[model samples]
Each structure stands twice: as structure tokens, then as C-alpha cells.
Target chain A: MTAWDVIGFLLVLATAAGIIIFSSKQVRGKYPALFRKIPAITRLKRAVGLSVEDGSRVHVTLGKADLTEAANTSTLVGLSALHSIGQLSANSDQPPICTSGDGGFALLSKDVLRAVAMETNTREYYDPDLGYLSGATPFSYALGALDALEESGAKTNVLIGNFGVEAGWLTGNAEKHAQFTLAASDSLVAQAVFMATSQDFVIGEELYAVPAYLAYRPAHIASLRVQDILRFLVGGALLIGALLKSLGLL
Target chain B: MKILNIIIAVAAGLIVLLGYFFRIPAIDDLRGQLLNWAVTLSGVAGLIAILNLIFGVHWKRVKEKHERRGASLVIIISFAVTLVAGIFLGPSSPGFQKLVTHVQVPIESSLMALLAISLVVASLKILQRHRSWMGFVFFLCVVLFLILNSGVLAFTSEIPVLRDFLSAFHHAPVAGARGILLGIALGSLAAGIRVMIGSDRPYNG
Candidate 1:
């Protein structure tokens, strides 16, 4: 391979390693301030409380991406959110309903919820079908979620993780129906686009900080700090690369 | 049984991956056949889904006095038109093609355009909501990209350097965007792998 190819490959490895290390640390609880700064992270508790008081259900959507997918960040965020929601809802009369596009994710969502219920001592409230595996196609899943929103009569829709253009349709429908929507995902562009139109609260890269906020794990916070540093490094690299290229330098 | 399911799923996933990457004739042939079968099955599933939608809508309209009867009517009419066109003129016939060109294409394109416009407007709303520096930056980028994409600025060819710079800026973001997109694709692929292995079963419910 050429030198540039090697450097590019290394860059990717560094980014991936950075993500993993940061994620692991965040999982262990390292950064509290970052999580606190994110309004959605704080609103989660309030959302759960409101859901309980109003006798309304919480809708948690695991975007179409499954756990094995490279964008494991979304799944990680989704799982952490599920853990929080499950724990909060355990003592209430209602349990949060988790929805997924893929069957594999559906199954994992079930396990995650079950685990959360066990941890919170609300195993009796655990519903295996809490994680509904809708259709794999984007539009199909949107339709399924629409149906779910209507049927469950959920009050707060907490959408976190990977989503696509169809998220617009789901969020639009939710807004029309007056359902409170909170959305977050790592794909900033798509989520930002959707959040722009819908009444959804969007959490961007903040999704990576979710585990830290909910679990108060030092590793999770440290990882987030590392990720922020990496983001700054990447931004710097891009700027320098652009300037060098403009100056006719290699 | 669980082990059997895992083995079958892994084998299927491997076949799919191989089909995507390999150019061997046998593998290509198998992949083609598998794709055909998948298409056929998807068609069947589509039919089932359509039936369910019809039933659900009708039931809702009847039992719950749903206010969206117009939507149901539109669905019925569109389906009928497509079915009639397909039955009488066949897929490639002039009548069917006309139906596609006139009815389908326009509707689909217009809807897509509407979606794009809505995305732009919604993004603006989001910027207003967050009122953060990052949000403003994102909003600015999206607006600039959309304006350039619309080709309205191309009419200003009278200013050569300005036009050139705008064009370059328009094209420049795409390279970085593509890289980010590739990373997302890889991430999605890994997540798919985890799901296939049953390590993440969020949908068992």
C-alpha cells in the first residue's frame, strides 16, 4: 500500500480505537458534566416521571441498526436508554415499550429490558414483547411505529439510536397526534434534519454520553472526554489538510 | 434448536456477504438465484402487508369512526389504478408506461421534492429550537448546500471567480460527507453482524 493509504488506514484505526476506548470508559462512569450539559439526558428522568403520573406509556425506538452493526454507538445508546427507562418504569404501573426494525435487535431489546427489570426488581412488569420487531424496511418500520403509537397511546416517545429518512414520517405523525417526542442519534445530519421539522428533542453526539449520564460510570465519562478530544483532533487534521492542499503542498 | 437457528442464520449471512464481494461464477449464480427468491418472497410479503393495511384501515374506519377516510380512499384508488394498468397493458406496454410516467413519476417526484423542502424547513426550525452554535453551523451548511443544489445560483455565471468558488465549495463537502457516510455504513454493517449472531436481540418482543 502507498504511504497515504497507510496513513488513512491508521487514521481510521485511531478513530475506531478512540471510539471503543472512550465508549468503554463512559460505560465505567468517567464524565458527569458532559452528560449534565445535555438537556435530553436530564429530561429523561422527568419524561419517565411524567409518563408514570399520567398513566401513559413510553415509546423507545431502537433504530433499524442492530447490535452487530458498525454503528454500534446507536445500539449502545439505545441499550442504555432502555436500561434507564426500564428502571424508571419498573416501579410504575406501566412499562416502556421498546421497538426495533430488525428481529435480532428485537430479541436483544427484550433481553435488555428483562435485565433492566430484574435489576430494578420489577421483573413482574417485564414484557418480552416490549421489544417489538417491526418490518425491516424503513417505510414499513415507520408504519409499524405509527400503529404502535396509536395503539399504545404512549405519552412520551423517546427515539434514540440510528434512524433514516423515514424518521421524518414517524416524527411527523407523532407531532400531528400530539405525542411528546425525544429523539437522539449519532447520525447528526439525518437526526438534525428530522428534528428540524418535528417536535422531537434531538440529542446528537450526546448519544455517546448517555451511559455515563444514566449509569454514572467513570469509564463512560472518560471515553466521552476522549471522544471530544478526538473530534477536536479530527477537526484540526481536516483544517490542516485543507490548508496544505490549498498551498500546493503534499 | 437455538444452535440450529444460529448456524442457519450465520450461513445465510455468509452467503449474502460472499454474494456481495465475490465474482466467482458459481457464487454469482447462487447469489442471483437467491436474490430472485428473495424478491419473490418479498412480493408475497408485500401482498400480505397490503392486505393487513387494508383490513386495518377499514376496521378503524368502521369501528372507531376514524377521520382519515380520505387516506383510505386514496390508497384504494391508487391500488386499483395500478392493478388495472398492470392487468390490461402489462408492465412494459405504452398504457402502463404512461401510467407510470404520468401518475407514478410525477407523484413520486413531487413527494420527494416535498420531503426535501420539508427537511430544509424543519432544519431551520431545529436551529431555532436549539439556538446553539453547532446547530447554527449545521443550519448554515444545510442552507448553503440546498441553495447550491437547487441550481439557482448557477445563473450568476457573470462572476467567474465567485461562481467557481461556490461550485467548488458545493462539491467539496461531498468528499468529507462521503467518508462520514462510509463510516456509518461500516458501523451499520457491524451492528448487523452482532444482530445476526444473536448477541443483540432487541426485537424478541
Candidate 2:
């Protein structure tokens, strides 16, 4: 390993650990306020509440990527958000239906649903059918999801995960079905697609902030804080590098 | 059980993560072995998932007496036929290749072609809904990029203004894309750290 690689890895580890430890020790209401305006998150809250009140289902697609990849932070965050939404929808006759393209992800989604159901004392309503594989590939997954969402007549479509241009079709299909859609993904192209197709959408790392926005989990919130700090550091470093380059300094 | 799950996750993740950096022989061997096991398990899981999807859909159709039962039957027949053909005729055989090329490729292509129209409609929708500077700028960029890059207009490179605008616009979005990619990388790293330290455990679910 290069010196820089080690340093970078250690820096990330230390910062995250420090923040997590600090945040866990703080009492309720004592944690520092870290807030941002993400319309998709706001819409997700309203959609969940509305779906429960109106006796409609909420469908959450975890996109095409599985947990095996190194860069599957999107799926992780999506699962976290799904857990929170699952808990919120527990009281409803129809809880949220979580779908995934990968088999392992489907299994994880089911586990999350069961955990949420148990936490909410609604285990009887937990159905394995609610979380299962839609399709293996990206386009196939999109097609499968589109058909299922339309057939189910779900009121709320929460799509957050690693998707590509296929995401455009899913969002468009949801719109055609007159469903309230909230979309987010770690893929830039998919994020761009979401930006164009869905009014309530998240971009970039704002997706990682979903768990914090929904559940208010201390560690998740602290991770966001650490992310912000790292982002500023990286941005400042880039600025310095650019300035140095402009001055013909190495 | 929970501690064991955490232990397995941490050990496997650390071996893989650190093996990439340190050139330790034992760590590299362990990483390779674990990854192979993971791949094999993933394949089995994938097969199970397909079975789950097929039976789940078919049973639902039968119970509800949905008209799509015929479609589900067709899917089963097709899946069985493909599996048999792949196993007997070999995947590289002309039959398998032709089936994939003729069926799967076209379906994927149609979806992609559909995306072009979806993109345009989505951009228009964005403009209609937002009606703001950001929306206008985004709309203009998409239109300009499509026109200049897609070769919709029969314009020559001789036109200085069009050429300059096209050249500049082509690289403009790359800067933003790079920023987004970097942000995603950083976010993933932080997330990995959280998981490694047991602060966040998606596997528990």
C-alpha cells in the first residue's frame, strides 16, 4: 500500500469512529442540529403517512445493485431508509413492499422488513412476498418493477438505490400510474435521470443522509456529520491544489 | 448469533479491505478464498431468487386467477427451455447466442431507445414544474448537448460559434459528474468505516 492510501483509510476510520462515539454518548436533544432541506425526504414522510391513512401500499425498490460490490453504499443506505419506512408503515394494513434486483439484497430486504415488523409489534403483517427479487439485470429489473408497481396500484413509490438510466423508465412508469414518486441513487447518471423525471429526488451523498432524516439514529447522523467534515476538507484541498497549479507550483 | 454475524462481517471485510493495501501473502490468499466462496454463494442465492420469483408469481396468479397465468406459464417454459439448451447445447453454441441476441438484446435495446424519449419528456416536465433558473439552465444544457452531440442538426464544424459552444458544453458536465463521483466515493468510504466498526450493521437486517 502507498503511504497516501494508508493515511486516507486511517483518516476515514478515525473520523467516523470519533464521531460515532461522540454522538452515541450525547443525550436526546443535546445532539447538535444538522439539518438540510431535501424535498424527497419530506415527500417520503408525507407519502408514508398518506399511504397508511388511505389504506394504500408503499413500494420501495432497492435498485439493481447487490451488497457484494465494494461501492454499494447506495444499497446500504437504501436498506437503512427502508427499515425506517417499514417501521412507520407497520401500523397500516399494508406495509411498504421492498423490492430488489439482487438475490442477496432481496434476502436482506426481507430481514429488514421482519425486524421492522417485530419492532413495531406487527409481525403478523410481515410477508416474505413483500421483499423479493424483481429481476437480475438492470433493464429487466426496471421492467419487472414497472409492471409490479402498476399492477399493485401502490400510492407511494420510493426508489432509492444503485440504478442507471433504467431508473428513468421506472420513475416515468410510476408517474404514468399516478403514483407519488421519490427517487434517489448513488449513480450520477441515475441521479440525473431522477432529477429530470421526479420532482422529489435526492442527489449525490444526500442519499446517505436519508436514514438520519427519517430515523434520527445517532450513528447514522454522526456518519453524516463526518461526511460533511470530510467533504469540506477535500474541497479545500482541491482549491489549494488548483491555486498551486495556477501559480506553477507543484 | 449477533456477535457471530458481526465477527464474520468484520473479519471478512477487513481481510478484503486491508488485503488491497498490504501485500501480505496470507491475507491475499484468505481474501481470494473468501471472495470465491462469496461468489459461489451468490450464484446459489441468485438461482434461489429466480425460483422465488417464478413460483411466487405463478402461485399468486393461480390463487387470484389472474389472466397473467398464461404469461407466467410461458415464462416457466422459456426459462426451462433456455436452461436445458444452455446445459446441453453449451452456452457458446449458435442456439444460445441466437436466442440471447435475438430476444434479450432487442428487449434491452428497446428499453434504451425508450429512455431517449423519456429523457426529453422528463426535461420538459422539469421545466414545466420548476420554471426556475436552475431548471432553465438544465433544460438548455440537455437540448444543447443533444443537438450538438447527437448530430440532429446538419451543422458543419466550420461554424465557429456552434463549434465553440459544442466543444465547451461537451466538457462542462464532466466537471459536475466528476464532483458527484468524488462525493459518492467519500460517502462510500465513510459508510464502509461505519459498517466495519459495528456502528452501522445492515447485515443485522
- Per-residue C-alpha lDDT of model 1 across residues A1-250, encoded as one tens digit per residue: 4576566556444544544555453544553344446676567667777888888888888777644455655765687678767777776867888776655556566778877777678777776666665555665576667767776788878777778776776776676653467777667565655657554464445555565666654344544555566556666887899999999995
TM-score of chain A, all candidates: 0.81, 0.94
Candidate 2: which stretches are off by over 4 Å? A27-31, B147-169
Query: lDDT values of the candidates?
Result: 0.64, 0.82
Model 1 lDDT at residue A90: 72
Q: What is the per-residue lDDT of model 2 for residues B27-140, given as tens digits with 9 covering 90 to 100?
A: 999999999988888888888888888888655776677877777677777788888989998999998999879988998998899899988877878888667797788788
Local error of candidate 1 at residue B151 (angstroms): 2.8
Superposition error at A13 for model 1 (Å): 8.3
TM-score against truth, every candidate: 0.63, 0.93
DockQ of 2: 0.65
Q: How accurate locally is residue A169 in candidate 1, as Cα lDDT from 0 to 100?
A: 64
Residue A204's lDDT in candidate 1: 43
Candidate 2 C-alpha error for residue A180, in Å: 1.2
